[model samples]
Target chain A: MDPAKLLDILGNENRRKIIQLLANRPCYVSEISSRLGVGPKAIISHLGLLEQAGLIECSVDEQRRKYFNIANNMRLEVSVSPYSYTVTLHDVTFDRGKNEEDPVEKEIPPGEESSTLFLKLSSRLKELKKRQEELAQMQQQLQVEYTEAMDHCLDSIEEIARNPVECELLFELLKNETTLATLCYNLRLHPSIVNANLIGLTKRGFIEYGIKNNQYYWKIRETGVENE
Target chain B: MDPAKLLDILGNENRRKIIQLLANRPCYVSEISSRLGVGPKAIISHLGLLEQAGLIECSVDEQRRKYFNIANNMRLEVSVSPYSYTVTLHDVTFDRGKNEEDPVEKEIPPGEESSTLFLKLSSRLKELKKRQEELAQMQQQLQVEYTEAMDHCLDSIEEIARNPVECELLFELLKNETTLATLCYNLRLHPSIVNANLIGLTKRGFIEYGIKNNQYYWKIRETGVENE
Candidate 1:
């Protein structure tokens, strides 16, 4: 699913609350509307959008009441940093079909203690939460390091670039190697100007160019500056 | 900052593109407008909102032109699963002031090789990206496990609950301990109904209650079901 579209769908307060309420268990329209203090009509509209997005699904009970519950188990991550903006979505699944030995897939024997099962699940959840926290901290540390590296790279580029256009070109190249056409589009520069700058930077040994698939691409050289 | 509020601010396509452009380098209004193919008036409006949200900042360059760049480094994560929905925002920082030995803060002497610095920064970034991917995979695994645990808990509750009210009560209590007032609010049930169900579940030894600060709170018992 597109991240931007998901963001737009979840931007509303009522929609987010509805999803939160449904996360616990399935509920009919009146139950959600009454609990959230929203009118049933508005709640129905929100549920319709959520259902279309495949985030929630509806089922009919024996009494002919329709209940809504979470449909997909997924995660959406948006990372905005000085050097990057990324959105990632993960579809989480516990494939009981693939793993026959999975404890959750095993049927609970009649008369077995429910409390024992609850304790086991709760404790396992707690352990996973702790480990997730640790991983988050590590990711933060890496983010810090990344910011520092980009800052240094920018500083170095500023010192070497002879003009603003060259500086901008270097910064753009830092993201990834790109063809001249893409660079012209991204930088909004005329082909001639972009071509001149690319050739100049290449000659100065700050960057290099190569042909792949019969198209020329430019990237910053990995090695230090070469003085011929 | 509120995650939902942030989501709203970034939901616009133009605003996101503006931020993506600024991520590379600081750009003045016209530069951003022309590059993004958005009119200056609309870009300015988007900029105003982004600036208000503390995501971007403006500065006057030597030519007295207003330039905009990313004001903060942050990560926003939203997780939606069968049992939970959460939004988290993290402020990423590189505290050079506290770390004197940091290489990024050191001044590069005049005529120092820019290529060497670029190589170092690029390699470090590549390494961090790899590690971040590894961490992401681990987190996905945890999410899968969490879904399984909640599914098991729900199945067990369904089997043990005497009625739908009791089952719903168990599901609500699984989220956290709360007072009767709060449970009534969340469950949107009449006070008498919630109170009677709580009492019934407690009598069955499925849950327990305690008073703190003159308010009673109910929670699922940690041990297995009790046979009196």
Candidate 2:
């Protein structure tokens, strides 16, 4: 329900374009789809998010032609100066001076509410700036950690596979269960070579063997090592 | 950068919590990390995103302790109701009637600026509401289309791999490229069964074998089917 969430909904480029398209008038899904050159399915998802954010609303006619339009009674104002930036949104009706019964005690217009809120906000600007700095550092650290996490997985896989042949074998073992004869046949390698890779794979705990109908077959190990 | 980008930067719960913590006073990263019970690394990443959004700022003290504080001269306010929601931001100095040089002319306070903006906003509410309805219908259509697309893919995959085992094999191959022996070993199935699955897999063009250094290795086909 926070207005900040609206920004998240609009953060997407497609959503913003959708807003611009609907800014002046309402539009149907197919119309927007054709205009944007995107699949109707994707446009629907974006529109759903927008509606949830209260930026847009929808209706369906008897023919099942869905129409979309922007929400009403909402105001968004963003002003930025050299030293500071401010974003304020108001959907509540402000009847500050509308009650004229007390002319003797003139009521300041509802804009007074904003200035009061703004005063509180301005006072906290120093604090917000500090949070901004922390956020910047956090983003950098996340990118590094994300890369490290990915590299760690890849490195473990590479370690298990060791060589291209072993890698290919592990990759294949990852998919299907087969016997030594079948592996050798499909791999176009000697049974001895296939046996060597099989032994290595078994040692890595990546795979195990079983006998069915008096014939041996190999399959992925049941343990968590398969993920690696 | 667009201000909407800020929403994405602050969309994370951690970042929002960080903002609330920093709203009152400055604090070091370690302090925030310990309070939030998040690792320093994660906190650092969150701080980075907040900083990028310009919601907070930081400085390193002589003790090398980075102190974070909120930015100054900024205000963000959001209001929401069942029928509508509004977001307004102001970051500029309000000059009501600062200059006394001009006689006989009283400058309306800066709150007047908001009133004017609100009037403009009110006028556009009708247009926005229409857009909202259109957006809602678009979203519904999109959901149907998305489900339809997903169903189509599932139907195709099912048609190709009728058995559950074959389906599992296809799913795994979709992720990795492996050999017959390894596939048999990992899947814990008989080699003959693996060979049958391999035959089916090759037919579907999901995989292909190539000879490298006298050894045949299986790899995913280069075609876009790899994603499926």
Q: Which candidate number maximizes TM-score? A: 1
User: How many Å off is the CA of B142 in candidate 2?
Assistant: 35
List RMSD in Å for every model shown: 3.6, 35.2
Query: By lDDT, who's the top model here?
Result: 1
User: In candidate 1, how many Å is residue A222 off?
Assistant: 4.2
**Would you estimate the TM-scores of all the predictions?**
0.85, 0.35
- The two-chain DockQ for each candidate, comma-separated, is 0.53, 0.02
Cα lDDT of model 2 by residue, B16-64, tens digit: 5677666534679988898789999999888877777666788999988
Off by over 4 Å in 1: A93-110, A190-217, A222-228, B93-110, B162-166, B189-228
Per-candidate clashes come to 2, 92
Candidate lDDT scores, in order, read: 0.80, 0.53
Encode model 1's per-residue lDDT on B1-228: one tens digit a residue.
Answer: 677778888777888888888887778999888887889999999999989988888999888989998886788878888788888888775464454576545665555566667656766666778897888888888888777777777777877788888888988887677899888877678999988988898887778887889988888776666573
